[model samples]
Target chain A: MLIPGITIKKGVCQLLALNKFSVGQWLKTFDTIIFDADGVLWRGQQAIDGAPDTFNALRAMGKQAFICTNTSETSREKLCAKAQDLDFLIAEDEVMSSSEALARYLQQRKFNRKVYIMGGQGIADELECVGIESLPLDEGKMIGSQMVDYVKNITLDPQVGAVAVGLDKDFDMLKLAKVGCYLMDPKVLFLATNRDHSFPVAPGHFIPGSGAMVAAVESLAKRAPFSCGKPNTFICLHLLRQGVIKPERTLMVGDTLYTDIQLGYNCGFQTLLVGTGNNSLQDVAKLQRSKLPLMYQQIPDLYLPKLSDLLKFLPSRNC
Target chain B: MLIPGITIKKGVCQLLALNKFSVGQWLKTFDTIIFDADGVLWRGQQAIDGAPDTFNALRAMGKQAFICTNTSETSREKLCAKAQDLDFLIAEDEVMSSSEALARYLQQRKFNRKVYIMGGQGIADELECVGIESLPLDEGKMIGSQMVDYVKNITLDPQVGAVAVGLDKDFDMLKLAKVGCYLMDPKVLFLATNRDHSFPVAPGHFIPGSGAMVAAVESLAKRAPFSCGKPNTFICLHLLRQGVIKPERTLMVGDTLYTDIQLGYNCGFQTLLVGTGNNSLQDVAKLQRSKLPLMYQQIPDLYLPKLSDLLKFLPSRNC
Candidate 1:
């Protein structure tokens, strides 16, 4: 389980409030700062106020900033473009998204094989970029009783050595069955981008996340996938293998503790939870004392009102 | 929770080996017989040998029989027609399918409102026959990103007061979202036909069952529904309300213990497990001694090789 400088461990945590006295120490302690996209940087297409300047401030102090997101709808190139358009200057290489992480995972393992992807353009494009051909999920080809027939007649592609799952709007019974059938071969790896059950689009407006889709397929496949997103150290491990980010000298900043802060801790990084999104202070308080084994790592070492709040404690926004 | 003519308790059970001495007494004890269709009387399209003649012989002996199935693919009319084609003697009224049961449930509750059905034509036809209007989950209507916009732009039909889920081959992310959205209101009753995870279609082939679809929605909805099939007493309660089936005088027979045997107990009927489909003798043996709180009713009172095997103790079918 050892990956570079990262060591996985389990324990409860206490959140430390940011103050002027502790702000300088935070900026100089980390060589890289990893931030979650949706709630930490931007909500949908709109960037949270002062989020740009906060990253700039981190960079000005000689600390690198990376966007580590689980948003699977868009590819890394699109994510960089979107971030730039929102005034948050970002580069494609600095964007370690679930989509990109999956591709990296395949390449690092030297698994030069075609994939059957139950996902969207993010995964497809990433696979193509990584030189991994994907068996297309033809939406029009399968529906109603046709799904049964297709599954019956299906011949597993020998080239398809893996099945990659994510937040696929095109997810259907046919795709589910095909994946399950392919996974019947124990050697055929099952890879999921993330397992966030639901993500909030706006206040009180939540959509079923990729985890729901994953759960549906898992129910049929009778197995869990090697999920590459937060709370699983695979994403960070990928970064570690690349030699760009040092886990010991990294700070993980995010709005939610579950995927964000817990992921940071799993990868042996300093974790921070901001209160401007999905979870509340009370939610963290409950998880810190949670007896449920499932909530074991949902804790953080530090937290603030928002990522932008750190700007007040920074000296300058110039690198 | 005690019902008349039913005793509730616990402990391991022994499978009775029927002999000539006890066969006559077993036949005279129950005036009515409840059979689960897919695994017991039939497997997919083909009927188990001697199944048709067994029901006919039971009728000649003045015993009433019903085909109680969780297969939601076809309506009662179509089921009866299919039975006739397979040489099985079944009337429309005697075929109590999950689809028909759902419609009857709505009628019984007087919830005469439009339904949002995430199911097949069986449920649609049954609902129409019961005079309940439905908002169709037309497969062609929702797919890909269009699903996101459709879910967002969709206006809630105030008349839609319930959402029924079943075996839907067209099940996808869009349909999952729409149903989850509709069930946001606590007033919108959520109903599922059954929860059989995977059903064997052929010797080594299995298809993901209605339960997988239901699980997808339930994961998104964060709540379970009033599931109506085997193992749930609701279907039996519906029959009891009709005043034709006497619980004390009924015998429930099927191949699977999870649905058939537990359902028989849930409805206050004598249970008989047949080894013609799905489950094996070892499966039953394991369940008979299970101490899981949820599996208290899984043990059956009687079992044999098949329904046709009962002929050894009964008079010849001259009808």
Candidate 2:
């Protein structure tokens, strides 16, 4: 079958479309494959056509597959369950989420103090899994009608050693102010789950994401956060350090450019862009024309219309 | 009486302390004066010691004095009333607040459609004063428990032509999301009252300002707001355009450097820094050492211990 909407290209600078000849060669290059869950495998609650079979086929071929997402709204367990529900073979241990990354970061530091959270219950659950305590998410609300009264009456928790921000449904001014006060102590660690500004809810429709909440607190605190999601490089450094994957032999596949592609570039891994999510060939073409060297990092090594398109290039028995 | 904690210095690069010898010459250089409220005039409800007498004395010197503040919490009427209650002779029309500037901006554009506001009632009142209607401030809250439900069920008002943001006590994720949706249309105007990140609430304590709220929306919307307050130049450009004051002959007096001093530099007005608010000589010295040309804009032309210190330099009859 001919791939639609992709021109055959040869150079790494150009967005090369995976054809029968190139796909087979590309499959031999990467021993480990890291997939961005949301846009590559599925969008929202629905899995893309043939995505599950494509993912399962890669695993069946003896290729290591891991699900990496910037979502702070759910835990690894929930993500694994959702992936299983959508027919994609995934395990809790094979998933790495922003919230999970944050929890791991604290655990690595052996941080015992409580954390002030401005996110969903998932963040709290992740922290709890690591035996790290977090303040009640709802306790940050304003104590009175006036902002001054709230500012004057509210007291900062001396035990809070860090402030973690993620996509929050209940984000408000009081929480923003509370985070600001906690961050005033220079010793307090400021962490953000991810910095995806907006995420698509439907075709051409997007909603504010965790980055929006993080930006508010950052402005008030006058400091940038230590982000634990894609493009930060720190998220995937552990895998490289543990010798789980070699940079030259690893392939990072996703639908987003700035996060997935940039992360791949930062980690020295080959990147593949799929059209089922946030970006397309046009975005890559635009980036290719940019004068800045930084833009080149967002360009992918290869392109496919969707994840399922790769299944045809694999052996039928694997599928 | 000797002024405390000031070392006299010369040149614009140096933070020049106001002395008796230079006070008369400085007084004659400007026919009009702009004063920043809050720290310069008062701290909360209490007037800075001898501040009212100093202000009244400056007006008695035949200088046109105006109270310019970035506060969006109250109307011009309320600010004028507060000024009078604090013993300063002021007229309602003499106050140029952030909310007032925003209202005047819409009035100048002859905008007729309703505004979607994320601010205090003061913003709505100011818009009403100019015959423009704004959507109810409290109506933007989330309708359900889930962010997806809120995003799917909530509808954007077609009548809203502009989205105005200020220091909102009730700022939340829903308002941020609603603004994001409205801003998806390229025609909808995005306005911010000011970008003051944080304001001092008490000694060594600060609270999140309107800039915090604006930053969140700006990140989600992926657009910059046309700010109406200090440091934006638009706030005082009207004064220069209407021939109300000559920039060369006007003096901008305040306790903040980023807003008032930068506004003065942008407007070609002489800037005065008083040590009653956010910044001090330490900040000015730090800026002077910076290699960036932009940092020089924040260095004030003159400095005083407090607004009241200027009282000693003026004629007793004026006081």
Candidate 3:
């Protein structure tokens, strides 16, 4: 039976049953695919079944696939290593993590400002890869000790022109205070990796994510940082502008709608939602019935129970 | 010349010129006085001249005075010691600090749950004084390291019935996450000492105050702590209910209108704004012209340059 009110093939047509739309149907119109990792390709560190085979089959079909994740902790090399270890066939250059996007965005600008980071070693490594220096990660600990006296002790360096915050284990008052100090100077760029408030670590457990840490800094700084993640479109659009990817022919696939599907919505690309992650098809159907401000949030173009379901959609039995 | 539009007396008559309306007149109505320490009685650690003498004079006039401060770091004994060093004599029992108020608030209920403290030694001392145990101040640090994995690692002691925040010199993420873990129980009391965002350190310098720290925790916990400071009236009224003071016969004096004067407004006590610390006469006059939502922000009942000015209002005073 069809799940009524689902979005597919765009003109607001009567939607078909869930998973009825095939990858062969999606591939007919789209040549490039961008995947959100946590839900689509894998959960935590585990590779979802049929994921690697689907990507391997897509490559055999002369299609391009890229990993576009908001995971700020892992470096590009690490992401590629994880994919390789999981037997997912993807090139290292094809992985566009939020940390890498931040690095590329800064690299494009030739940003000279020594950055103060409120993130993990991945961002530090990426920033260093581009020759943009970031302040010591533990600087928050040292400066925060003196913060009890005055913010004066946590002074901003004249060259520190940007403050980048991502998922960090060391999210503390010192880093937050240092970020607040630099933010006082109006010239500094406040770059945040993403706005995800919480994520599932295990099936039953949820912990505060980067969005929570970013908000703590944002609250004190009285400013919002521009996120370099999915919804921002800076990552994929950067590739599109270079003529490597065409928005009209690209499909953005993910488990979550707000970040993954909205990112596709933002970039004017076709979006596919899979139920193997944070959001499910029922959640989307229920949202469509309610009042939500963002148009992108109300629905996704097409959704499947899992990425592996697309395997059945391939027209060729060889697929 | 008197500052026009200032609040004075019960009839709301134009405030008299400065301290021109003698203490002789203030004594005729308000027999008991509550003082905010930082700006009203002293700036930083220095006491204003004639502050002790005025208190001594009020004592001689058969009046009652109480020190109601939000200084969380200092114990009641320390407050008395500081008063002694400043040449002011006050009974230890009469001192009501935020830490002490929290102690009494917990004591009244006979809370069996151990408390998590995001403050200094004084609150810890005060809690122990009332037979309530507090977790180690650095417990946040120990538990916070495991937060990256899961909030479950930051175990909430079944006995930790409350989390109280104040001006902690060692504010960090670990402490915030721990506080958040305890707050998840919903039954845990979220107690904050005060909500002072910043305080004047010297002539022109200011430091991030306890309010900033409290806000960080409040943001993560998704709740506001019950403030046990001057403006909240929890402390003042707690004593009032015990028959230790009467609101009708009391005057609340402070330098800052928000914390000090608002405390009086909340408790229905006469309020006097002193200029020697912060929120000068000109500042109040400026705020009066602008529309304000809170009644206390409209105007205080009176204004004086400093506490010493009250010495001139003393009856039968000898040079």
Candidate 4:
């Protein structure tokens, strides 16, 4: 059903429901497709029904398919393995996780010093992939009960040049204190994987994301981190810079509005919102009614129940 | 020296330097005095010079002095003991800590459920003192490597009704997760000790305060906590309600502007800023020049190099 009262302006179709005809026309508009992993393709360990076939069909149609995920818990290798296990056709390098984006960002800057990581081993591995060294995560955990003694004896590694933050189950006060100490020197770079506040674990159940960890360190460090994930444009800079994907011909598909839709809007890509994830048509309608121009950026150009629904609209596929 | 550009209003004096005569007049203006312990009376374990004698002299002259501190790391009993150790004539009941204030807040509400504490033992002890039970601080620490397993096995205690956050060296993601889970039930109260971002440990050295812990949980919980510490009128409500102190005749003294002076401004109490703590005369001068009406609330009515400076100006004490 088409959402009522949303007027489509030139070059932007706000909350237009995609039918077979519209989907076919939409498919012809984008040569490159960026997919958000968690919500659009799968929910946790389970892939959205027919999502793999839809993704494969998109690639088979000569469209460049790239998976851009905000999850920093795993590296691209692991993400590729996960995607393959779910029967999606994917190349390892075509996937850009926030961790990978942050690693590339540091690599591009020629950052040579050791990193103080307040994230999981995924970030550490990504940095390692770029030949960057990170301090052992266990070193700061030895801060015993005596905070004063710990502060007095705290020896900041002079070689440490950056603090990379991501989602970590092991996040604690010791890490926060160490980050604060390192950040006291104005030269130390503060970087975050993403600022996504929370992600769904189950229906209506959400857990704290990397934003929580970043906020904690931010409170202590008294500074903001250079975020590399959506809606930050830094995540797709390499693709844009290398002319791999022309923005106008690219379609960004995801469930979340703030990250996926906003990123697509910022990058001048056509955005498709899928119901299998965080936001819904109702949310789009609410944003539409609010009349805030900023919120309008989060309203996707098209909407679908799930990514797999597009499979029927593919010209090569039998309805 | 008097702040040159500042103009003294009818009721508010912005950064008037306290000299012998002005200090005597200032002493006569307030019948009750509220002192901030950390920066005003002492820094770390060492007592600020002449602070104890100055405090005692004020009490000797029939002024009611109370130590209203934002430190939630210790109970009132411990605070009184520390004050006594530093040669201040402080009674156990005369000290009001953020922890104590939070405890009273819950007690006043007749809160019966167990508190999920994300703070030090001080908060737990304060809750216990007010006949409230808190969950064991170590229960959340046993969350092992597998977050999925932990989340799947997570059992929130039905009795837990509130999450009290303060400075905890042991603060971790597990606590944040638990708080997130508990807060999913909107009826659960979220309380914070204070929101002071950082506190001075030594000259030019600072450490993350309770605000860091609060910010972490806040990011996860997606709601602001009811802060019971300085600048929140709830902390001083009991004294004000009981007629123990009149706001106009009460002087709030401290080194921090945002907390102490802002609290004074909020409570209609005269504010005194001392240089020995987080803020200084320069900060006051800067605020004075900002011309923003809100910033003026942080500009103290009186200024002194240290709390002990008032000792020389007390009429009862010979210079």
Candidate 5:
């Protein structure tokens, strides 16, 4: 929560104008800073340079800094190990992941059901951690069938209640056909982990995220599922539950305006835009000229080269 | 030509609703029959089992059968080779691909300028064949780079005149970035080959068809491109040029109600829904429940199980 150089008077104006300087002031002002890992701290293994210094600066100011990554690839312990390797102090509770959020949400809801999953082990593990049985394969000959097939095949059974959609590697024609069939029954509740089309690029190349699979099934069944991560308000609620952020005073900073900035806008928090991630400035300008939501343009109170650039405006005392 | 067991009658309705005995009476009713290859005679490969017999039956009746496909994959020669393998006698000019339609439309418009293409060889070849230069790759320094990195990056060129979007495997982030940057200039005209999300299942896994890349760039740019294929009346106009089938008398047989039926309706052709491929019965049923476009649920005059199902309705002489 320490900004390195700005005076208190300058900090006040920064917050009011909500400019890039104000974002740095806000980062210094808060006791606990939550960072979205992908765009904020790092993209895959290559850490965003200055991420460690920023976190170290926060700790030097006697504030708590945590990484809230949407990635389900790493467990909390692994994340802590990575954080330590990056020269930052991180604890299990200080790290919140979509996988963990999904697990917690499922446990709290106590929706006793068998989730027919079309995703990765992270999704299945999350469901199982909540004491829910996970079914990975199609049991009722719904495979390779159309929407009407569900009514004829699986909906008759009370055991089959909900369908969970996520990134499924081996998901092919049979899985898609089955998901489409199952979705049309109307009795089954559908849940999409996230609606991202492509995740952050890594050595493996860009893989199709959950949204493509979700989109394929959604288009066929003509039904939208309950999305539960990133831009979804549910993730914001999870952040609030951890007592890490006060909605009115918090700021969400990231490279993508649609997800990170939009999340901030929805949560009544200030936002900062970094121009180095999923979307480009030209895309933003295009949206500005068209039917893009007004709140989207207004959502980001600041624009910075990257999250690290905020350091320059930090209050000297806080640093 | 043969419509399963139905007979043609004195009028259009009578011709559509007649039984096998009366089919002989309607044999001489229509002078031309147009077929869509993707869903009718064959799907990617391995012809529809009963296609050869149906074509032979129609040939016996002395009906002019024309194969009109929305595919951009094959040229007239390749299409003929495939049809021959399926035992259907098709002339080179009798088959019309959407690529040809796009070529003709572009040639007639006489743009006579460079086109930044993101499609197959068919599109590139068509443009070249019509004396137009293809300019798909990045030309020079892109506009909107606030920094002087443009001076260092040779890939960003500003000389592109137009962008034509079609199916291509080379569609990647760099291409999209270039397109986005070029589009920001406002002088580049945008064109899309088609708007289908997924094509028929081929030997390899489902490739990201043109529409996928189109949607990605379109979402960022927030603009609709000029469609040059099915559901767009341009191709229908091309068919009308050859005096092959009177627009009013033509029957468009396709499995997809959206593209095929919509194209048929737009072209003033009676549409026959063949539900055994691509779209299913429930897909149609869903449209019936909504206030969709007229073509969505204005039930086709005939519902054939497949293109082969039409064999039952052909005149006895045709069979």
Candidate 6:
């Protein structure tokens, strides 16, 4: 029996019920496709069984596929290298992460301002490349003498220009107080790097991320911070400004309903979901039951068992 | 020949009018008196004319005259030395500046929070004495560079906890932008080191002071800054907290009608104005037609030619 409210291609409903046609078969109509990493390409130690073949088949059908991830863990080049190691054909630019978007955004600005960053060297290095001075919060034992003054001086100096909020393990009250005081002056601007609540690390645990800190400051300041990374329209607009992708035909695909699907949906792009990522089938069902509903009504236009199953879904090129 | 609104003693009135007994004796009512520096001692240079003779006359009356100048220009040691050079007797603590009040206030609260400053080294040093970190806007440069990134990286990084607005020469659009963005975050606390709109410089020129910058940020953030200088109730409250002076008995005397007189009025102290200072006799006269007509209603209780003349007006110890 067909699941209530589940609409598929007319007459194709019968095909779905018979279990003969998987949802992956609908991929043929689109000339371009975007894939999500992690759950789609691989779960952890092993690659998804059908992903590699599906990608190769899509190429054979004269279709282009790109992967967009919100992961700050790896650069676009590194992501591409990982795909190459997995025996997949992918370009460097095709692998876009929100971190990369943040880096790109900072790169194009015509500002000589020095940045005191809390994020990894990736962000620092990116900022420097654009002629922006980058001061990473130092972490060394020999400089411990200056560290006391440094911590004390953190937000109290008007010379700081701006305080770049990013991921840091050593975050504490002093930092909070300094930021609070510095922010109280309306002349200083507060920018949020991203809005992801958490990023997956291992199977059973998810790490607290930027969204936590952002929420903390937002609650205190009683203002919404301008978000720079994924799902926020800024990153998307920046991407368009860079001529990286055609917004009209661009598709955003991911396993996570938020950050991925909503980003595509909100930006008026087609979205696709791959099972076995941040959310499982059970998690989606539970989300549907929750009172504070997720944007599940804005679900992906297409769904697949895994990234590799896409090859079988594409219509015959001759047809 | 008597001034229209002049209040002369009954006997003095009869003697001066030659309607009664001859002007045999004139009783000087006040002797011992305190003087505030910014408006009373000297505004940016040459001393008030009658300042010296007034003190000398008080001393002649066996009155213990003290020079209390709240000029944060020099340390207690320097202030005492300066007073000596200016022909006045004053102790280190007797020359109380708002800097001292701020330091004491922060110390009492054990506020270890970093203070982003836009003032002189005096403010920075004062905050440091209380173990509060100080970030001077001048030396640290404009914080706008850091602010842009701060606003952009709000979610991913640490936010400024408190913003201290003070006097800075290099205060510009960049500084304003940074401050503006920082204040957008609600967690940030807004403060003004002082609300002095203009600092007296040379004879005919004035530098737009901290109040101007504070006003700029306050306008954007839509909130009044927590000011900690003369006229601001914070310093008054701080003094009260430290048991330095009681609001009722405390008398604030200075030349500037805005800072000195307004402070005294707000703190419920008797306010005395020296005729010559930032607001000259001409400025005061012009106030009669001011846009805010009732502003002049809050006039000083005692108006003297200079701080020195104040000794002649105060009620005598024996009288």
Best candidate according to lDDT? 2
Q: Could you tell me which 10 consecutive residues in candidate 1 chain B have the lowest summed lDDT? A: B1-10
Candidate 4: tens digits of C-alpha lDDT, residues A1-319: 1223334553334333435665566567789999999989988888889999989998988899999999998998999999999999998988999999999999999999999888778899899999999998743253447766666556779899999999888776656767888888889999999988887665435667899888888888889999999999999988999999899899899999999999999999988899988888898888888757898889887778888777767867542
- Cα displacement (Å) at residue B203, model 6: 31
Candidate 3 lDDT at B173 equals 57
- Report clashes for each candidate as comma-separated counts: 1, 0, 3, 0, 31, 69
lDDT of 2 by residue, A51-120 (tens): 9999999998989988889998788889999999999888888888999999989999999999999987
Clashing pairs in 1: A60-A318
- lDDT of model 5, residue B76: 60
User: Model 3, B1-319: lDDT tens per residue?
Assistant: 1223334343123233635544345557777888887776666567887788887787788778888898898789899888878877788987889999988888988888899898888999999889999987773243334655755455567788899989876666556656666776788999999887556544333455677777666766668888888688887776788877788878887888778888888887888888777688776766666656564353677777778777766764553
**Which stretches of model 6 miss by more than 4 angstroms?**
A1-25, A43-46, A140-160, A173-185, A200-204, A219-223, A238-248, A282-298, A314-319, B1-319
What TM-score against the true fold does each predicted structure earn? 0.82, 0.92, 0.77, 0.90, 0.68, 0.44
- lDDT, residue A176, model 1: 74
Error of 5 at A2 (Å): 20
B-chain TM-score of model 4: 0.91
Summing lDDT over every window of 10 consecutive residues in candidate 2 chain B, give the lowest-scoring window: B1-10
Better of 3 and 6 by TM-score: 3
Q: Write the per-residue lDDT of candidate 6 for residues B13-104, one digit (tens) a residue.
A: 22223211221122222223446775576544445666655655555555444444334434456666776677665566555566666666
> Where does candidate 3 chain A have its weakest 10-residue lDDT segment?
A7-16
How high is the CA lDDT of each candidate model? 0.78, 0.84, 0.75, 0.83, 0.62, 0.55
> What TM-score does prediction 3 earn?
0.77
**How do all the candidates rank in terms of lDDT, highest first?**
2, 4, 1, 3, 5, 6
What stretches of model 4 exceed 4 Å from their correct place? A1-19, A139-144, A203-205, A285-293, A316-319, B1-19, B139-144, B202-205, B285-293, B315-319
Best-to-worst order by TM-score is: 2, 4, 1, 3, 5, 6
Where in model 2 is the C-alpha error above 4 Å? A1-19, A139-144, A203-205, B1-21, B139-144
